[model samples]
Target chain A: MKRRISLFGALREADARGYIEVDVPAHSTIAELREAVQHYAREHAPAISPGLIQRSAFASGDEILHNHRSVPEQGELAILPPVSGG
Target chain B: MTEIYTAVVDIAHGPLRPAEALEFVADPRFGGIATFIGRVRQHNLGRVVTGISYDLFDALALRTFQHIGERARQEVGGPMKLYIAHAKGDLRIGDFAVVVAAATPHRDEAFRACRLAIEAVKHEAPIWKQEHYIDGHSAWSEGCSLCEEHRAEEQRAAGLAATQAGDAHGHEH
Candidate 1:
């Protein structure tokens, strides 16, 4: 299945792309998805720091997901860094 | 005599209005209403900041606002109304960046809910701020860490100066 990973903040800076489509096995966990995203960033966007990827949070819809959590195959996977809104 | 819990969450491109936020939580039965408006300051840390640009993940941000409202209601243990509006895109100094309001039958809960809502919005919402400095540099700010760092540095410098002055007085004695 192809998962559309949406980047935000520093993650977007790392990806150098708004989003990227990656193929993963069914029922892929967020940990696996994050690794895939990192790999994509490493390959595509060299300017993105490893520190940024390490700090990023993965979310499905509005809920921030733990690495162990199962990511829904549907919908965009948001890359959320430390939020600074007032 | 109003809804048990009324929530209004918006991620807008234009300026957020405090009046609209206040109106959302207005109810005849509520005895107290508390509202907080966050404006873009002309300076941050030691840097002269001209403006800021807010970027938000709208769908997720709204979801976070709703969750915050629910959490506030549960914690307050009362009927309440919550209104939150956040601005996106470019904002000049003194522009309203965000507005949070809470209305309840009592002052305590109203204050608690309002505080919680704004804090949660700052920590939880998927919004990023890029501060434009007068030095012609712009960078993303994380929880205003840059400002915090500057403050810390100033405090450290002041402490060192005070210690040095005390040492000079001791020598004179």
Candidate 2:
């Protein structure tokens, strides 16, 4: 399936750095998704707060996936890198 | 008294205004508004500050911040309103970095609460400040600023770095 992966600020180079349009099979677990994010992050740029690749995996802990307000996919989730305040 | 809460962090094409923040909790009962807005400065230690690299350890950091607010509220008054936001990522010179606002009935309590909140924030929160100095030097803030040994070590490192660069330049010449 196709899903958008966004990395703001310094990580915006993914478009040219060969990190975009990465494929993920359906029913990928949260851990698998997080690994995909880290893979893309490393490919695009140096990893910052790699731990957040795990912490931000599901967006929030309230509900398995839906409770997350940041990156919400019906049953899917995102593992975003550590981002700064606006 | 009404209880109000507004807490989050963001980056912007603009800056943060303390007065605008206070409006979030403004009400008839709020007779006082005290705030702190931290602006990016031009200097730090020895090197000039060019910008900052902000990285927040949110789970523990925000949890601890909420706890401090709860504690201060107990000491000051119940149902007091607060709005605190920390800027993340790169903040250029003159950009806003930190903001804190506290509201209460009497001015005395409001001022006291504001003072305590800012002080508590610096020491308690896990917010780390990494400075990118203007002289091609960038590093995290060293703890224990009052230590003479630490200062001496810093001096030595700067001296060595300068000497190494100077020698390389002389060799090329």
Candidate 3:
């Protein structure tokens, strides 16, 4: 399954469209999604480090998802990097 | 008709108005009002910062701001009004990036609420800032260290859990 994930902060620099598409198995958990995203980054976004992806949290709408939680079947989710806003 | 105001939170795409925040928090019943403004400075870590771009997850950011306001009000425990606004998009040096204001019956509560709101917004809000330098390069500013701390804590807990499971398995064998 293909999921479109919104990118923010430094992750935005990775793709000009400000988002990325990752291929994951259906009903993949957040941990699996993160691995797919990391794989995509490694191949396409060399500037973004695996550590950064590892530290980032995934969000569906306004809620942050735990690693154990499954990704929603529909809708684009966001990848939140370590926040710096004051 | 008189207006009842408790909290005003927004992810502003344009410049943030501190005056508007002051107006929102203004009330005859409140004796003190505290305001905090965060601006983009010219230099950071010995590098000259020309500008900054702020990216935000609008829905989550606003939700977090509301949570911060409610928490501040409860923590301070008084009739209070709070205002929080954070900039979204490009900003030059000296531009306001965030504004937080709190009004309370007493000075201490007002100050405390204001401080609490700003701190929460800095650490909790789903917002990111990329600092553009004079050398035509830009990098995301490292804002909250809490994320790293939380990650470390999670790793530690997982390690402990794995070790405990290993011990149990060894005993069973």
Per-candidate iRMSD: 8.2, 12.4, 7.3
Quality class of the docking in candidate 1, CAPRI style: acceptable
Pairs in steric clash, model 3 = none
> Backbone clashes per model, in order?
0, 5, 0
Q: What lDDT tens digits, residue by residue, belong to model 1 across residues A6-85? A: 87665567545677777778888877877887787789787877656655677777577877788787777777765688
Segments of candidate 2 deviating more than 4 angstroms? A1-86, B1-6, B12-17, B143-173
Residue-by-residue lDDT tens digits, candidate 2, B1-173: 43434344646545566776788758687888888888878886656999986654455446545766776688776547776667666678878777888888877777777777766666445455667887787765532111223334434655755476642111110
Q: Alpha carbon lDDT of residue B136, candidate 1?
A: 92
Clashing pairs in 1: none
User: What is the TM-score of model 3 when looking only at chain B?
Assistant: 0.79
**TM of each candidate vs. truth:** 0.81, 0.54, 0.84
Error at B90, model 3, angstroms: 1.2
Better of 1 and 3 by lDDT: 3
TM-score of chain B only, all predictions? 0.76, 0.74, 0.79
lDDT (10s digit) by residue, model 1, range B98-151:
888899999999999999888778766888888999989998875411122332
Q: Which has the greatest lDDT?
A: 3
